[model samples]
Target: MRVLMVSWEYPPVIVGGLGRHVHHLAIDLAGMGHEVTVITRRPSGTDSLTHPTTDERSDGVRVIAVAEDPHEFRFGTDMMSWTLAMGHSFVRAGLRVLAGDQETAWVPDVVHAHDWLVAHPAITLAEFFDVPLVATIHATEAGRHSGWVSGSTNRQVHSVEWWLANEADALITCSESMRDEVNRLFGPEEIQVIHNGIDVDTWPFAPRPQTAGPAELLFAGRLEYEKGVQDLLAALPRVRRTHPGTTLTIAGTGTQLDWLMETARKHKVTRSVRFVGALDHNALVAAMQRCAAIVLPSRYEPFGIVALEAAATGIPLVVSTAGGLGEAVDDGMSGFTFQPADVAGIATAIRKTLDDPAAAAVRARRARDRLTEDFSWREVAERTEGVYLAAKRRVRHAYGRPTIIERPLPERDPGK
Candidate 1:
């Protein structure tokens, strides 16, 4: 099947998990023999309205970067104008692709959009090309702000999300919790729960070298309010009372860094906490390798990919019972789950693992086995392909016929 993926972010221009998710999914789809084309916004400082640059990866996926106008966007107006501009750019690129030589003039069987950022363009292109549309709701504006669309910008985003869910032929979410949320909020007709996957071989699994000090606890992700990093910091003092040699390492950068540091100071655990800002891929893997255990204390996590990555690295995980973090890991068999914002519970879970390294290692091994057995890119791509086929069938049935494009292809040599 030929697929066109629309996203606002991609690698080297990622602000969150959406870009990484799209990158891995697209590559795996290509590997599965599907002709995948990705359309995304180019990074800042690039020329607006410049010709889109198309790069074909060795995995057979073609990525087309369309420049976005940086100066014309502000807070509340950003999403609207951005989507309009991106939709225009995508339409232009689609025309160019359709105008190419016979061998290169390919049309997509399905147009898949990730999140609300690209919803407008995805809907427009699907209608223009007369194909099926699939939209993946990674998270909702209401979910992110705890069911409160506080400001004008957030309300606008929420409206767009609702429109996208209603417009798509089928909806896809990363977890059951997300599916329920989408159903309650937007009421999509059909929704599929496809968990996010990771590459198991990406992280090295060798035992971390021992250093002469406390057992290091790692919390890697955005240091935001919803992430519950502050709660993790608050739990550190309690954890230290039980295991004085234990330390907490907070990685990732966000708006709450300063407040988190202040919280640590207030808790008087500043000495026991180390705030290492953002980490690249290699550094993140290395940190996972060395940490005694990985803790994700999220107040609201639609789907915790970090927990999956940690489990893949053979690290014992202690995640909060927020959205999908609890679903990602077994309570006791694989790892422990504590209630979100429960400082005592978080500390107790961490303390138990620190006290019994053998038990923790056993659980980590189980988690790793589960990750390898169940969560893999191959399985994810196969399931995603199934969703695409299902959506296509639905569209065909609705229209009472198969989609056909009668445009002329440019004449050129077949073996160009």
Candidate 2:
């Protein structure tokens, strides 16, 4: 099958977990005897405008890059950056198609778009070609529980998300929890739940010597209010009271970093909490192995990939029962889930793990086994391919013939 995979970003240009997920899925699909052409925005750099770049045969996958507007790639607190990037991506993809390059002549049998950021272009292209479109909603606005956003931003994101689900042949989400959410919010749409997977080999398995008497708790990923980072900080004071030497390691940088740090100081827990800032994969995995257990205090998570990463490393996870985190963690088996925003609950869980290091080790082993058997990339790839095949079948039946789709053209050409 020929597949056109659309994502806003890719490796060497990751904005979030979604980029890494897309990169792996494409590679695995190609390995399974499917031809995959990834369409993504070129990273901002000197090579941003050198026409189409091809990543030929890496892990048996072929990737095609179509450069997008560099200005829209700015990263910050503005949520609109993603929406604007999607708009430009559509224009750039359209231009590439019109250029009539033989290198990209094989139009996709099915279009798989990841997240709301690239849904606009994916929907337009699928409609233009009358092909089946499948959208993977990594997260949702309602899940974030954010207060009202700008009218334009809200409407734009909501419209694209809704249209993608309504127009696409089927919808894909990372967990059964997300499947239920999409169904409840978007009416009865065909939704498939594909849990996120990790490369076990990539994440080293040997357990590092646990942090001494003062247990170190690690939290990695974006630092945002919705992520419950502030709530975790609030829990630290109590955690320290029980385990006097407990040290919390907070990694990653975000809009809420200053406030989070200030809150730690206000509670005089700054000495107990170490703000490690953002870390590369090597450092992150090392931290994960060394920590007693990984804590994810997300208000709502679609699928706690970080939990899977920790579990893959033979480390127990304490995650919020909010959203899909519950599904990823098996309470008392591999890890435990607590109610969202309960600082006391988080602290208590930490203390329990610290109380019996041996018991905690048993749980960590269980978590690692679960990840190895169920969530490896090979298994994930096979399941994802099932969705791609289903989408391909849907497109074939709907169009009755092969249909070639391209992104929408811009109203005005800036290059001119």
Best by lDDT: 1
Q: lDDT tens digits, residues 1-416, model 1?
A: 98999988887678788888888999999988899998876775465546335554545778877765446654244657656676677677666765366787778899999999788778878887788899999998778766766566667778888888878888899988899999988766479998888888886565534455679999999877779887898899899987877888898998778888888888998888899999888988888888899999998899988898888777788999888788888888898989988999999999888877778888988888888878888898899999899885244323222112232333321111
CA lDDT of each prediction against the hidden true structure: 0.81, 0.74
Clashing pairs in 1: none
Candidate 2: segments with Cα more than 4 A from true spot: 44-57, 70-82, 94-104, 146-152, 208-212, 392-416
- Candidate 2 versus the native: TM-score? 0.87
Question: Per-residue alpha-carbon lDDT of model 2 for 10-116, expressed as tens digits?
Answer: 77668777888988888888888888877776665424556445444466655556554545344344567746665566645654663357775566778888887
lDDT for model 2 comes to 0.74
